[model samples]
Target chain A: MQESNARVGAPDWLEEIRWNADGLVPAIAQDAVTGDILMMAWMNAESLRLTAEEGQAVYWSRSRGKLWRKGETSGHQQVISEIRLDCDEDVILLKVEQKGGIACHTGRRSCFYRRLEGGQWASVDPVLRNPEAIYGKKQGGSNHE
Target chain B: MQESNARVGAPDWLEEIRWNADGLVPAIAQDAVTGDILMMAWMNAESLRLTAEEGQAVYWSRSRGKLWRKGETSGHQQVISEIRLDCDEDVILLKVEQKGGIACHTGRRSCFYRRLEGGQWASVDPVLRNPEAIYGKKQGGSNHE
Candidate 1:
């Protein structure tokens, strides 16, 4: 959508978003230093508010139906350096300082590790560390929702 | 979610994704050259498959409930150079060559032009072009769904 440089005068910034029927908006986490997109997840108003207040990444876990604080489980927390809202206001961008240098639960630098090559998805990035070491044995399964 | 370097052997690559209840997944578009995240949009299986086959971005508009071909209206089409799926098989990333050097309907180079500053969102980027000229006066409204 075409927009002028928006002057957001709303007292309640979270209310300005065009949230979906589920009261959620897509949030993308990008490395503040490298500009590498770490991951994408959903956030409700509560999670969005918490992220701003806490200066950390907090997302709504659709599957768990609760707030998913980044790095809470794996100790890989994302320290929020800046937050951005798209021109459309349906998407949020978190410029973060990824604490562990690993944003993917798969134990990689970023979640986007599989690139489509020759009509097939290939692992273009190596596993930086073992998943078992990151999530522990029982919770080692990757679930980035 | 922790995962191995996924070996996507499924005949139907689309089936591997964990689509939301609305059968939509979020797709991120990044500038292949600069790694600047241009925008984020939703895609159903149909749009995702079309993107792969057509080598361009085709998203599903939740507001309009139809397929949206990038640049169809604005001549700012995204020529995708690479597509990456997240480790959890939930999110899709498009590394693209953004046409006209503009990815935002706001006439900016990227949709993420607003930055959080002192609890307020401020427009930090300049509008590179005029939206009315890109989308015509009648279609000048920005809608990046």
Candidate 2:
């Protein structure tokens, strides 16, 4: 499939990416409308391909060493509007419509909630919802931490 | 310095980070005023500490195996306004004012100027300034490619 696509000079999409030595690239998810950055994750070729085909966020979980469909458990899937590659071709930008409004496993709008203030890290953004309510107590506690 | 700070229960800032196996973390630079993501890079503990101390972006270049002060050569320094950490404590975000209004080595405002269109990565953003003008002939051609 890749060979045929490359020959046609078509979207041999994955071929152009400058994957790291581990064959992975960092993917950042941004809100299409608000332009707020939601989260950052890693993706392998397979997951990237699947994301394009599926029109959603799919990442490779390094810890689990497996494919992770965002919001599969929590139902907070991201609907992709656009996929962008950086000038370096080493990173990916996913302009997505975050479904649940809450992108962080901590039930915050974004994962980046702690800001450095007065020589310490402080929670600048409030948690929109409780993790226990979103993922259930059994899984919520350890979901994204 | 680190020992004293830790003992005082003060900003033992770097200790809370979950650096990768290589003792590095992914850092994202975002435009403080416009909220645009300018670039992404890797940072070691020392670089992160220096960034906090200097109020500028300092990244650890994997290819060069050394520290990289943003704009040290190109004069496009990013003055950091805020430092944020993700909920997982893995990723770092810098809200910065990009000097000269250019962040990419390609002389664009952002490194992520390429957008995926019709199965191809297309340059969506124009070159705000010519690289040759910025870095000169010998250095410009190969600066960020």
Which structure among the candidates has the greatest lDDT?
1
Off by over 4 Å in 1: A1-11, B1-11
lDDT of 2 by residue, B14-50 (tens): 7888888777889989999988988899888888888
Docking class of 2: medium
Q: For residues A1-145, write the lDDT of model 1, one tens digit per residue.
A: 1011121332468767888777788899999988898998888877887898899998888778778898998899999998999998889999999998999888899999999887688899888888889888887455556
Kindly report the fnat of each predicted structure, to 2 decimals.
0.79, 0.79
What residue runs in model 2 are displaced by over 4 Å at the alpha carbon? A1-11, A140-145, B1-11, B140-145
Which lDDT tens digits does candidate 2 get at residues A1-145? Answer: 1223322433476789978777788999989898788889888788788888899999888777778899998899999899988877889999999998989998899998899987788998988898889878786333342
lDDT of each prediction vs. the true structure? 0.84, 0.83
Each prediction's RMSD over C-alphas, in Å, is 6.6, 4.1
User: lDDT by residue for model 1 over B58-135, one digit each (tens)?
Assistant: 988877778899999888899989999998888999999999999998899999999878767899999999888888
TM-score of each: 0.89, 0.90
Least well predicted 10-residue stretch by lDDT in candidate 1 chain B? B1-10
